[model samples]
Target: MRLLVTGANGQLGHAIDAALEAKDAPAAYVDCVVDWVDLPDLDISSASAVDAWFVAHEPYDVVVNCAAFTNVDGCEADFAAAFSANALGPMNLARACATGDAALVHVSTDYVFPGTEPGERLETDVPAPISAYGRSKLAGEGLALAANHRTHVVRTAWLYGEGKNFVRTMLRIGEGRDEVTVVDDQLGNPTSAADLAHEILRIALTDDYGVWHCTNEGICSWADLAEAAYEIAGVNCRVRRCSSADWKRMNPQSADRPAFSALKNGHLESTIGNQMRPWREALEDYLR
Candidate 1:
């Protein structure tokens, strides 16, 4: 099976590559070739270029799009660039997948939800993105679904692991700051990229096609997440409880952020099954 992975340099993409390189992991990838395409090698923003590459290389089994314009604030600052990469990129790939008869695994975010105070956002929740980044991702979801290709979209959030993420950011800040303040009100699950990669493999290996949510079990606020990071990293920094407004004061948030955007996994729980451990467990393992 020939698989093409976009955004090869990202945290999720890098985790997939790491699993492929592991000796004890699934050998299906041994016979299966994973084409890791980064920028310059492949740019999702160019439709013609994407079409040409797909036609030339012809990904046999699937195209895993791990690429996206992830910076929330940056997206608000430059909506065009965000749409070009997030929305148009998936649009082009979905079209290619449709033409080539290949399955697609598209990564989405919890930000697509309104993040209002409520129960965990079910898969059926209406998407009301608050930020430009969320809007772009929602657009990608629309394009992928509209393409009508045999595709899967996995929505996750608060991701970390071997990459610059919230946890890492907290640990880094703790290195100097005696006290750190994080958002205490906003709630979301902290997903590890490694676990998300494994979940992606579960979907890919089974060829199950649909939208799924694969976040780490349980939920917490940014302040809670920061405290955990400090405890795990053996850092003795005081993490004060604060609101989003506090953090956004200096590092002004680019896009509107979800206040409560936890994703429930009724589908993944019943269908392909979930191997993702609790957020705390995944966090500990990632730190190790």
Candidate 2:
């Protein structure tokens, strides 16, 4: 099946690109190769550009939309840009899919839940996003979920990979500095973008058609994940735990963050049987 992966330069999309050709990857994910398209070639934020590309490409079996406006603080500062990239981008892609009779697997986030309480966020749980970024992403999910009626939204969290994540950030701080500080109050699973990409492929192929939550099996605060990172990387650093309020005080946020927003993957497991590896294991593999 021909597949198109958006945001091919991003960690998750690039991982998916590599996994399609990896011999060690699961048989189901190995053979199906994808055509990776980066920003200018297929930027979903530009409807005309995306529509033109769709007209040219004709039909794609799966369009895995990994593209997102992911800067939480930036999103709050610039809601228009966030909505354009996060919400309208998916909407445009979903429209393209409808035009070409294609399927879509839109990746979403766990931030859609309002962090009013502490617990697991089930697939059936009603979303009450607390931040501009989260609200924009939730809008993206809603558009993609409703656009084609055949699309699936895979909500995930705490993504880390080769670069540009909390894990890597902690690794850098631990290696470069004597000590580091991370917020302990916020908790969620550390999802590997590579695993998430493969899971996206699984959902795209299967008959499961709706919003489903997927993430690594365990939970951890930023402090916990950072500590695990330092331990796995064998880097020595004193990690001090602090509250979200303190974190915000140090690094003022444009958006309100969810204190605890772990995704539950029971639906995806039952339907596709491609649950991601444990966060610890994935983190170890990533660090190595």
Candidate 3:
């Protein structure tokens, strides 16, 4: 199987690369040949460009779309660009995959839910996105699934890796500040991109395809995650937990987010029988 990975420079992409490398398995062993692609080399938003690249390259058995416009606040200001990247891009890939008779695996977010309730969300839960970013991703998920019968949608949350993410930001800010305040009301699982990448590869190898929620096995608030990061980094900064409203007042430009968007990986666990590590353990590995 020849696999195509989009957004090769991003966090999850890097993790995928690392995971593949660590496997150290040849195409014969895994029956796979991986091809990485990203912006400048290929613009997923442009349908023509996406088609042309697929035509020029070798036929891929699986296409995992990791590219997306993730800026929550920016999506509000530039809805068209956000929709083009988050929604249309996946549609284009889905069309290409359909034409080539290839399977598609789309990386989605927990933002797809309104997230007002206080419990783990199942794969069967209906989506009612509250923000522009969430709506765009939901559109992408719908298009991708409808465009191809062999499509797998994986919804994840609070992702971090070797890139600019919440953990990295907190560590950076802690370096200069003696005390940092984070929102305690917003709760979700903090996932490791590396772990998610590995799971994506496993899904791609399988014939079964559908929507699944994959994240670290536990949940926490922003303040709790921040405090954990500082603790792991051996930083001496004091962490102050604040309500969502207080956080908004402090950072007026902050974007609206779900209060409780944690997801349950019941489908994935049942299908693969591979348990995801706890969020705290993943965080420790990432920090180290």
Which candidate number has the best TM-score?
3
Error of 2 at 215 (Å): 0.5
Cα-based lDDT at residue 69, candidate 2:
81
Q: What are the C-alpha RMSDs, in order, of all predicted structures?
A: 1.6, 1.6, 1.6
Clashing pairs in 1: 73-254
Candidate 1 RMSD to the correct structure:
1.6
Ranking by lDDT: 3, 1, 2
Arrange candidates, best TM-score first. 3, 1, 2
Off by over 4 Å in 2: 24-33
Off by over 4 Å in 3: 24-31
| Candidate 2 local lDDT, 47-109, one digit each (tens) | 899898887874787888889988899999999999999999998899888878888888899
Task: Please write out the lDDT profile of model 3 over residues 1-288, one tens digit for every residue.
Answer: 788999988999898888877754334326467889999898899999999999998888889898988889899888899899999999999999999999999999999999898799998999999889999999999999998888999999999997879999999999999999888989999999989988887777677878999999988999999999999999989998889888778877777899999999988878886568999999999989
Comparing 2 with 3 on lDDT, the higher-scoring candidate is: 3
**Residue range 26-112, candidate 1, lDDT tens digits:** 666777877889798899889999898987884668788999989888999999999999999988888888888888889999999
